[model samples]
Target: MDFLHSGLAAIQRHLAFVAVDPIDWKFYVQAFSWTVTLFESYLLLRQYPLYSKTSPPESLARHIGQEDFEKSQKYGKDKAQFALFSKLFSQCIDSAMLQYGFYAWCWKAAGSILGKFGYGGDYEILQSIVFSFTMYLLSSLPTLPLSVYSTFVLEERHGFNKVTPGLFISDLLKGWLIAFVLGAPFLAAFLYIFQWAGDRFVPWLMGFMISFQFIMVILYPTVIQPLFNKLTPLSDGELRSRVEGLAGKLHFPLKHLYEIDGSKRSSHSNAYFFGLPWSKHIVIFDTLMQQSKPEEVEAVLAHELGHWYYLHPTKMMAISQIHIFSILALFPAFLHAPPLLRSFDFPKAVAARPPTIVAFLLFQMILTPMEAFISIGMNAVSRHFEWEADRFACELQDRLKEESMTDMGDRLGRALITLHVKNLSTVWVDWLYSAYHHSHPTLTERLKALESFQAKRAKKE
Candidate 1:
């Protein structure tokens, strides 16, 4: 308890220190820009998970037990998950646009004010207000079109979308309205804290943000997601029975399998294990059921179960919180540099606008490498978990039958290959490049691992 209290106190002190500092527009701009760019890059990389290097043609040929190149040629035809891939790609571009617009606006606004006067007095207050408003606008914009494209253009094109455009637009408007209503108080609180604690409040603000974010993470899967999609109990007889049996054997306390109408918006299939305790459930995409065989579906579920058994989500949350706290603690050191703030002509007080934009950008630039390091670490961990999941799935398959296991693995591999081909993913990716940006291990790596696991099991039998 003392340790926890001490840590909290330390974070508060750090927040306070940074909050009171006169704005440093140069540093702000640098930091914000770097952060936006890095974040965009990370998001783009996430799209890779939906694509695999092996083409559908290759996978199909392999599926029929074709070994020779001549025999494989007969099955060589490209079939891909084009709609999902296109949508994800477009979303990545949209993300870039939104981030760039926000950062550029802040940088200009803060720099303009700071160029006139150094930090102190009324200018500081003005700077805070501008910063807060800019943030709010950035957060609010881009929802309407992004959401629409996700459902209509991408999903509809692939026969996975069911939601009408009207519905999509309505949801967007409602979301924005909610944000405005609910977010105002928080924004106001932030501005007040900035003014009241001055340079001494950065740590506290950071702590507040971290704590708030943690709560949101816990609440989102249960309270937030249901607002958008219809989730129903998994009523399929064979699938449910098999999954339940697997869960029971593995000592996993799975209670219900829910089918989410993911096809209502998109064609891509997925399954996730979400929530905790009583709220915990498995959500499988309806599209997945339509597209994959039962064994393939089981394999995918096994992967999700792997995430649960390994407690990946909780681990990730803990890591993120620690990182946030650590960064907050360092706020004071930057705030103490008056010369740096003065260099950007930051103003003092609530009414005075300082060049915080520039300061934020600068800070973000310097923090890029640190962010990359953290992301790489998390990606590494994710890949390991994926491998473990594959192993678990293999074990489950073997428990059933050797031939069944092999056939299931083959079909699942083929499904991924088809999905990737449609998405136009290159078969061979640069491993080093993937290590830095990719979250999951490469498809080739996963397939090979599965194959090796099956072979080992065969030997044991």
Candidate 2:
């Protein structure tokens, strides 16, 4: 009893020390980010048991074979187990850095090192650039092995990995090069704006950000994507003709259809409509075209076109801009908070004016909780749009191809099931997890929506 009492006392003293030692926003940053990590880990862990115990619903059972069903279960379990380990690893590294002021120490050390090389001024662009690069290098190195293992080992074991070591290394080098090329100038400009524009910097920075994102949207398919993968004009075929006809009927400004070499990376299939209004292009993954029938592929394209018709992407961009604006609006308070700086072990003088990069990093860590909630809402909106798009695909296919709603629904259903099998993805997930993370509805949910639409149309007929 005495030993037990003394042990309890020691534990209480340790808790008190942890709680009261860092009375600054850094403590909250550490706490909040860690809590969010643990919460996400809990979510994934909870879903596993629920998912493993649940049998395939009758509707799903009709499409997915029992053997495939079991495979998916194992797949989910394996992925979940790895994900838990990954999350824990990430949290340990991040929590250690935040708690031990390693990032803060790095920032100061990087600045001092840069100063010796004549790159140090009051927030010198060169210093900030070098500092940012060093931080990225350090953080990325730790995570790279996990990603490599996930790709080469776990995914390979599951038969999903197509990335060879040479390709993987090439991808990494190209990605880093692209980041340095694009990010350096943008970051330099951002720091310069903050340093020079004084109070008006917020709006200017926001405007610049909004513009940058828009430009990226326009350029990604044409300029950026071609850097990594080969893209060719979709071959002339019945599918291409049908796609063009459908585009014409919908009055979608489709310029060219391109097929991207997605199979080189993974067997997963996807299609998207991207680029500026005049330069709009539809990119179908080669894997998707190879796997899907013309009708199913057409249905997929119809769904993508529906997004434009409903202005879903535009609305999403608007939401994203609002999120950015809100965060930027709060930046002044976060930037000026001395306790936030001191909590990271910044000296009193440095705390008076926290560096922009430090401020951004701290803000991101502190905003984890808010971002999680916001993400849920965004995902909800996205799922709704996906349903709308699915409905549009059904309606358009019925109108153009002279197919019954049921026919179109079955095609969509078959395509989804095939995708699930090819990707080795689980058929269903926990409702809460799906709601928070999935922007697209489950196969069962989508089929139900399509069936409901069919029933309503039959009644009208």
TM-score of each: 0.66, 0.91
lDDT of 2 by residue, 1-461 (tens): 45633553454444343323445777787778888888888789768885474467787877878878877788788888989999999888887877787777777778889778776557567766777888888878888989998999888887778899999999899889888988999999888888887544667888899888887886677677888899899999988987897789888999889999998888888888887776578889999888889878887887888899899999998898888877775565555566667878878777777777777778788889999899899999999999988888767645665553346666776787778877777776788878777888887888788888767777877
Which ranges in model 1 have alpha carbons more than 4 Å from their true place?
Answer: 1-134, 138-163, 181-218, 277-279, 335-346, 350-366, 397-428
Top-TM-score candidate index = 2
Error of 1 at 219 (Å): 3.6
What C-alpha lDDT do the candidate models reach, one value each?
A: 0.59, 0.79
Clashing pairs in 2: none
